[model samples]
Structure formats: C-alpha cells, structure tokens
Target chain A: DVKVTQSSRYLVKRTGEKVFLECVQDMDHENMFWYRQDPGLGLRLIYFSYDVKMKEKGDIPEGYSVSREKKERFSLILESASTNQTSMYLCASRSGQVRGNYGYTFGSGTRLTVV
Target chain B: AQTVTQSQPEMSVQEAETVTLSCTYDTSENNYYLFWYKQPPSRQMILVIRQEAYKQQNATENRFSVNFQKAAKSFSLKISDSQLGDTAMYFCAFMKHEGKGTYKYIFGTGTRLKVLA
Candidate 1:
C-alpha cells in the first residue's frame, strides 16, 4: 500500500521556537502538499510542491515555509511558533499525471501544540 | 476562485440505515472533479468517491454512492448500511483540471457523521 508517513504524531513546542514537521511518501508522487486543519475552519492549505525544489504558497502561507530537497520528502517549517500555530497538520501526495489518479493520499497527521 | 460548501456540520445515522451528506460548490469551470474524503478519528484521510463533471452518471463504490447534479453544481454522498466505522468527518473537495498536471483543490468545511447503535 502507498503511504505518506509523518515523522511525528504529536508535538509540543514553546513559543518563539522553530518547529519542523516532516512528511515522506514512498509513492514517488510528483505533488505534495501541507495543510493545517482547524475546527470550524476545516483544512487550509499552507504550501505545495510539484517537483524537487519547487514550492508554491497556498491560501494561508504566512508564518510557514516549506522545503522539498527531494521528490519523496516535503518539510513544513514554522519559523517562529506561536500559540495560534498549534493545529493539526496534514501531508498529502498525488500523482502529477492528470489522467490516471485525481485523489490525494494523506498521512495520519501531526498534532502540534504551541505554548 | 472555486469554493466548496458543506452546510451540514454534523449528522447522525443508525447502524444499517442510510444517510446523505450535502455538498455544493461554486465554480465557473465546467470541467472539474468532485471528491468526497473521509477522515476517521485519529486516522489518515482517505478518498471515498470521485465524480468527473463531464460524466452524467453518478459514481458508486459498494454501499457508497454519489448524487451528482452538474447543472446545479451539487455533489452529495450517500452511505448505505452505515456502520460504526463509518463515523468520521467527510469533506467535499473540488479540483479544476488545469489541462496541465498541476492543480490545487478547494475543500469544504466538512460534515461530521456519527453512527448510532
């Protein structure tokens, strides 16, 4: 089975600290995305990478940055963690080919709490 | 810009009963894809069903099916024989075929479904 693995399931970080959330996919999918899921607000996109070293900002990219050093791994970085930054983070990947698959396979998600 | 709306924030169904979750989208693009994704408690999100706007026929998988109304831009998911495992948050997503391989998806707020015994 194809899997998108997140490095951490739960994390607690202090304010002003830099936090990193890692996601790796074995599927070799060309597209990877980072989204923060909040209650009532649903999931908001943070960043997406289509290829190695290629990244695009999404709807809510503020206070967040992403790195895609390799095709299989995408990293989300919180430059300065704030209390409001605490939320459930999800990583997803999909085949870039528009023809075959349109669905995204998501990781179990990382729940980060900032204090 | 495209947007998806799931007006029903919460729903409940008895086991073995059927429940329908409503989803509506706003978009000018005629060619697009609609999807329903389910996220169980503490589990990864998974795709439940997908519908291509160009197709007139609704898509189905086992006890799960979709009611697609292209003219109204409404796509709803129906779950039959609901089980306890079916309790989860269901999201409606819309993706416009960019003609190229790269595109973004817009998701609804999501509907939480609880299965009652």
Candidate 2:
C-alpha cells in the first residue's frame, strides 16, 4: 500500500529554536502539502509544493517554510518556534494527474509542542 | 474565497443507529470537488467519501453516504448502522482547481461523532 510517512510522531521544542518536520511519501505523488491542525481551525495550509524545488505559501505560512529537494520528500521548517506554533502538523501528498483519487493521502501527523 | 462550514461540532448515535453530519460551503466556481475525511483517535486522517460537483448523484461508500445539494452548496455525510469503531472527527472539505497545477483546498472546523454501544 502507498503511504505518506512523517518522520516524527511527536516533538518538543524550546522557544526560538529552529524546528524541522519531515514528510516522505512512497506513492511518488507530485504534490505535497503541510498543514497545521488546531482546535477551532480545522486544517490550515502552511505550504505546498507541486514540484521539486517549488513551493507556495498557503493561508498560514507566517512562521513556517518548506523544502522539496526531491519528489518523495517534503520538509516543513519552523524558523523560530513559538508557543503559538504548537499544534498537530499534518503532511499530505496527492497525484497531479486528475484522473483518479484526487483526494489527499495524509500522514499520521506530528504533534509539536513549542515551550 | 472558498469556505467550508460544519455547524455541528459534536454528535452522538447509538450503535446500529444512523446519524448525519452537516457541511456547507460557499463558492462561485461551477466545477470543484467535495470530500469527507475521518480522523480517529490515532490522528491519521483518511478519506471517507468524495463527491464531484458536476455529478447530480451523491457519492456512497459502503455504509457511508453523502447528501450533496449543489444548488444549496451543501454536502452532508450519513453513517448507517453506526458502529463503535465509527467514532471519529469528520471534516468536510472543498477543492478548487486553478489551472497550472494549482489547487485550493479548504476544510470545515469538523464534527466529532461518537457511537455509543
């Protein structure tokens, strides 16, 4: 079965620390995304990459950045971790081809805690 | 701008009973996609069902079905014969394709459903 694997299931970071959340997909999907899931806000997109070395800022990309050096790997970076940045981080991948299963395949998710 | 709304924050149903989760969206685009995702206590979100905007028929998957009213911009999920394992957070989502391989995905706040035994 195809899968999107998130490197860490949980992480704790100190304020001002640089944090990295890694996601790797074996499905060879062309589109990868990072989202922050909070209590009241379902899932807010942080960044998405449609191709290697390409990225676009989503609705909530204020304190985050992303890198897609290869087709199967996408990483989210927290420039300066803050308490407010603590939330469940999700990684998803999708096929660029429009013919089948257009819905995203999500990873297990990482719950990040910024202290 | 596109937005999805799940007015019901929490719902409950007895085992073997039926329940429905409500979802509404606002959009001007004629063609798009709608989806219902389930996130269990394990925290892994999975696709429960999907509906194509142009199709008049609602989508169904086993015991999970959808009530898609395109004119009303509403999409609701119905769980039949609710099972204890069905307890999870359900999210309604809207997807709009913007050409050049760019797409916008928006999700509702989500409804937490509990199936009592």
Highest-scoring model, DockQ: 2
Candidate 2 lDDT over B19-102, as tens digits, reads: 999999999999999999999999999999999999999999999999999999999999999999999999999998899768
Q: What lDDT tens digits, residue by residue, belong to model 1 across residues B2-115? A: 889999999999999999999999999988899999999976999999998999999999999999999998999999999999999999999986645567699999999999
Query: Candidate 1, residue A58: CA error in Å?
Result: 0.5
Q: How good is model 2 by TM-score?
A: 0.98
- Write candidate 2's Cα lDDT for A1-102 as tens digits: 999999999999999999999999998899999999999889999999998999999999999999999999999999999999999999999998868468
Candidate 2 wrong stretches, greater than 4 Å: none
State in Å the error of residue A57, model 1: 0.4
Record all residue pairs in model 2 with backbone atoms less than 3 Å apart, i.e. clashing: none
Report the C-alpha displacement of residue A52, candidate 2, in angstroms. Answer: 0.9
**Alpha-carbon lDDT, every model:** 0.94, 0.95
lDDT of 1: 0.94
Candidate 1: segments with Cα more than 4 A from true spot: none
